[model samples]
Target: MMQLKWEKEGYIVSDDKTLLQMGKIEAWISGAYWAAGRSREIIEKSIQHSLCFGMYDKDGRQIGFARVITDQAVFSWIMDVIIDQEFRGKGLGKKLVECIISHPDIVHTKMGLATKDAHGLYRQFDFEMDECMRRPLL
Candidate 1:
């Protein structure tokens, strides 16, 4: 997949996986409710197989992150969306999701995501709860 980027208000969101800081991402995501106890190996594999977004500040510090599992044709499911706690309430999350959903390869695909609390945020992007069944193995 072609790497893509979006910039706004001095913050940048990029899909270049090489630009990701694994250590920081692992730390932030490991503390998240959905991904707590997730190991680096799994995270690394996820990034390798999925389309990942990393949001950075003017100085290039990563401030937010998200990834999408997609076929680039019919379906896209977003996961592990998170912003550094220090940067929340600044609209960075909105920008990050904007970049993801607006991405060229994903724009036309049906998108889905699971969020424990950020419903207001995703709803802004037209994401809504729908009837879908899942089988959990965890």
Candidate 2:
């Protein structure tokens, strides 16, 4: 996979696995309402298969994350977007979403994401609610 990176001021956003802080990611997702009790192995596996973005502070400590499962042609599902508690309210979330939507590989694909909150934030990037409901696989 090609690596994608963006930097602004003192922060960095990267899709380089080398820069990811797996421990931090696991800790955050373990407490997330959508992923509570999720195991490290599962997190690792998910990262391995998905296009992951990691946000780092000036000091290079990881503070945020998001991932997309995509075919690089038609479909993409953005998932697991989170910013560390201390980093919230600083617009990093919007930056992260912007990077995902503007990414060369993802921009033209049909993107989908589910959020219990943050609908307003995503709307700023043109994300709208889908009329179709998800069907479970047996």
Candidate 3:
């Protein structure tokens, strides 16, 4: 099984399958999509093309999450990173992204993500937007 070790907290990140895990990840992240009124179908469809990880506290309760979509070769886009409100400000976001960024499975691909206010959070992992613009570029 694929696993990620967080030595500081001594927890393992794995492929989450339980309903509790699914619910926890969904609950913490759904609000951003909801506030934008994104449909449930979009979220579910996104999950299929992505890799997801759930972070656990010392007691092993799910507390954080992140995901990525990639072609496993040239590029990837990280998405939906969040720690519960209670879990913020403790560096868990850093740890969670650390786990995802350094995962053995995805190390070879170029990574990217879209975020509004968390630019500071992702910068620590070397994520940034390119000057390359994709549009009718006026």
Candidate 4:
């Protein structure tokens, strides 16, 4: 698959795996409310398989991350979006989402995500809450 990238004011959003900081990403998601206790192996495997976006500051440090599990034609589930604590209020998260949803490979696919408190942010991009049913296997 072709990698996608976007840049603004020295910050870059890209699907390039070489730009991903695995340690930082594992640290963030492993401590996140949704995936607390997740293992490094699991995180690594997920990143290896998913379409991922990494946001880097001008200094080339990874500051934000998002991933989409998709077939590139029909369905996508956005997951693990996070911005570094110091970078939270600068709209980097929004840029990350935009880069994911607007990518040509999956832009027209049906996209979905679950968030406890980011409804307002997703709403700005026209995402609506929908009733969903789940069956836990564990």
Could you give candidate 4's per-residue lDDT for residues 72-115 as a string of tens digits?
88899999999999999888888889899899889999999999
Sorting all predicted structures by lDDT, with the top scorer first, yields: 4, 2, 1, 3
lDDT of 3 by residue, 3-73 (tens): 55565756455545341276666566667652244455666666666777777767888877777887767
Residue pairs with colliding backbones in model 1 are none
Model 3 regions more than 4 Å off: 10-12, 17-20, 33-35, 39-41, 132-138
lDDT of each: 0.92, 0.92, 0.70, 0.92
Q: What digit string (tens of lDDT, one per residue) describes model 1 on residues 39-117?
A: 9999999999999999999999998899999999999999999999999998888888888998998999999999889
Better of 2 and 4 by TM-score: 4
In candidate 4, what residue range of length 10 has the lowest lDDT sum?
A: 129-138
Candidate 4 clashing pairs, residues 3+ apart or interchain: none
Report the lDDT of model 3 for residue 82: 81
lDDT tens digits by residue: candidate 2, 61-129 = 999999999999999999999999999999999999988888888888999998898899999988898
In model 2, residue pairs whose N, Cα or C atoms come closer than 3 Å (at least 3 residues apart or on different chains), thus clashing, are none
Deviating ranges (above 4 Å) for candidate 4: none
What local lDDT does model 4 show for residue 12?
Answer: 95
